[model samples]
Target: MRGSNSSLSSLSRRQPWKLINIADLPDAVLIEVVCRLSCSKLIFRCKCVCKRWLTLISDPYFVDHYLRHQSDKKRHIIRTLIYAREYVVRLRFHPWTNPTVVATYNDLMLCYGNLNRYCICNPCTMQWVALPRIPTYTVHRRSEVRVGFICDTPCYNYKEDEHEDQKGDVMQHNAAYRCKVVRIRPPEKGYYHFSFEWKVDIFSSETGEWRKAVVLSPRAITLNGLGFPHQGILYWLGREENGCSIIFGLDPFSDKPKCFFIALDEPLNDLRHFGVCGGCIRMCGLDMATRSLIVFYLKTEEDGKLCLSKRMVYSLDQNMYLDNESNVSLRPFDPNDEDVCYIYVYGECVRYKYNFRTRKWSTIVEEIPHQISYSFVHVQPWWPTPVPRLPQRACPAESN
Candidate 1:
């Protein structure tokens, strides 16, 4: 028995241990395994494993599955992207000339460049598609124009190929095939006097075409700034002919598409900022008379009517903006935390962060170039969204 045991031990020691190679696994299994990895590991580590891994990671189908899986695990984390003069250093790729982020939805960013140029980008994967040139709209030069971006589908648990066999233009029913860019142009020079409808031009990725539409307003209103999307709806801050402030919303994906407006208690102020926070639309404005910051949340009642409800008020130092020549504007609020806010002192070229929980303001960034405006969009960082494919090959984004 001792002689037999010794012989077995010797045999086991001499034999090489069998190892399992992850790359040898089936594609489906491989996807299932890699989808669980963190975005950093998957992008920086697994993608470097081999050509197959890089290809799999870049696949749209795989990206969709990974996003759904992450959503199921509730692993998404909001990241604020500040695209200032130094943004070029952080973003490795730069395809557009003088690109500025105009809008963001989920993980996609819509960047606008000089001469009516626009492009959609997935910054994490360094993928971007230059959209077709936007056509000129015949509106008054003084009319304010607003642009927005949105996805027709939900952000999670959605399969791009679910309705592949639906026997028609699959793009119509498949949410994955729809991404829209909307341009709101004010009424022509003399048209606003008789009509409340504003001319709207919509560009759809599936059709690669721009279509004309109109949104009716309760009264003639002027869009204040670039709008932001929340819950698949784009909302803009606007002022009416009577000087009353209003929130204009457009539901382009609804079965019956329509535009609606909500009245605000106060008139539109240059220092007012609008954004989405804590899964709700919130607005922060500097109350110059009171030397305080007032926050408002958009709430819907049982009757289905929407209204702004006062959420909080924070007193500001009287001396902070005593310089009458200073242009003090409330910066875009952080989407993740309702208590954290930013204020930009344009004249001083400084941005300060105020924490309502702590009631303190600290300098976040200073000495910003006056020419470089603060235009940014929020995205979920851990989820690396792939760029939507177009019929034409997308141009590669290059780094400076």
Candidate 2:
């Protein structure tokens, strides 16, 4: 019996019990398991588990595959985190500090501090990269300089056979969308003084450099606040010199900037806003006579021209809280679910939420405007699209 017991003890010592031998698992299965993790930081740490795991995690092919899968499954969720509030569950431990918004694309957010500092962060992982100084333009008053963050539009996720170029295309293509910061400045003397010309600057992670260009726009358009990007084009709410509110579409990949009529009737009012939904640009307007808010979906054909169609109309229940000039926008919950969106009604000292799914209306918190400088965290799964790196720096205010 002593001999038998000794043999058993030796066997147990030689191979202790493990929950499961991850190393023994098939490489494909192990990768799938790692891809299911909720937090990338955790996955990153898991890479140190073993050499095989490390090789799989570090491979560009695996990274691109994972990103494409996550993006395709639409497994992530986007929840706006108001930075001002304390005691957020789980995230309370991270140091959000005084986060000022600069730009947003997918789950990535670029922000700057009150000083001329900058950072690119993913709230989901609380992982951030501090970036070096932008090559062109310095922080200035809101009237002079404006900054926006955008990435190349994501491609449709589809399964393809493994090949060198296949991996390269997916990895290189996805890495391109890592994040690009755009800084626009009006020439101090002329453009800032209604010269209508603005300087465009871009910082690309691929090249890790900033390039500057000038848009010698003769037409006037609203150049205030953040701009929107879609299908490789960036959009902003602006008005023509004739006082007609128009939507200006800027192709970041090109120098051509054009303006399109936002409303059927000329809307010179400043209470208008726009958002991207269902791959279309939605614009807000007011029917001056009826005082009802009108929303239109502007669709662009392959030829690059835009056509507008009235999508929905919302009538105010209580005019006291709602005004003819209320800022209205529709934020789609997910690209996969196009039928649903959240209507954000701002201005008039009142804030409310309108649900398009059930056509229900309710007043949400009023401090949302203050919470504007926040980030969206969607824990849902997304298809793999490899991303790049950036860091935070001390700079002026950033946009989202």
The models' CA-based lDDT, in order, is: 0.66, 0.56
Worst 10 residues of 1 by lDDT: 166-175
| Clash totals for all candidate models | 1, 46
Measured by lDDT, the strongest candidate is 1
Which digits, one per residue and each the tens of the lDDT, describe model 2 over residues 333-355? 33444443344555654555555
CA deviation > 4 Å runs, candidate 1: 1-13, 16-37, 44-78, 84-96, 113-115, 136-144, 158-177, 186-195, 254-257, 300-305, 323-327, 345-351, 358-373, 389-400
- Give candidates' CA RMSD values in order: 6.7, 7.0
Tens digits of lDDT, candidate 1, 1-400: 9999998899889995778888679999998988877764445467888899889876767766665666567785866646566455534586555676767777778876656767777666676777766666633232256788988665444323557564322111133547888888765654234347778777777666667886788777767666676666777777777765677888777544578678775643553455655556777766666667777788655543457765677887655664653377776666677677777676666778898779998886544334544456556655555556655432333211
Colliding pairs, model 1: 94-398
Q: What TM-score would every model get versus the actual structure?
A: 0.73, 0.68
lDDT of 1 at 134: 65
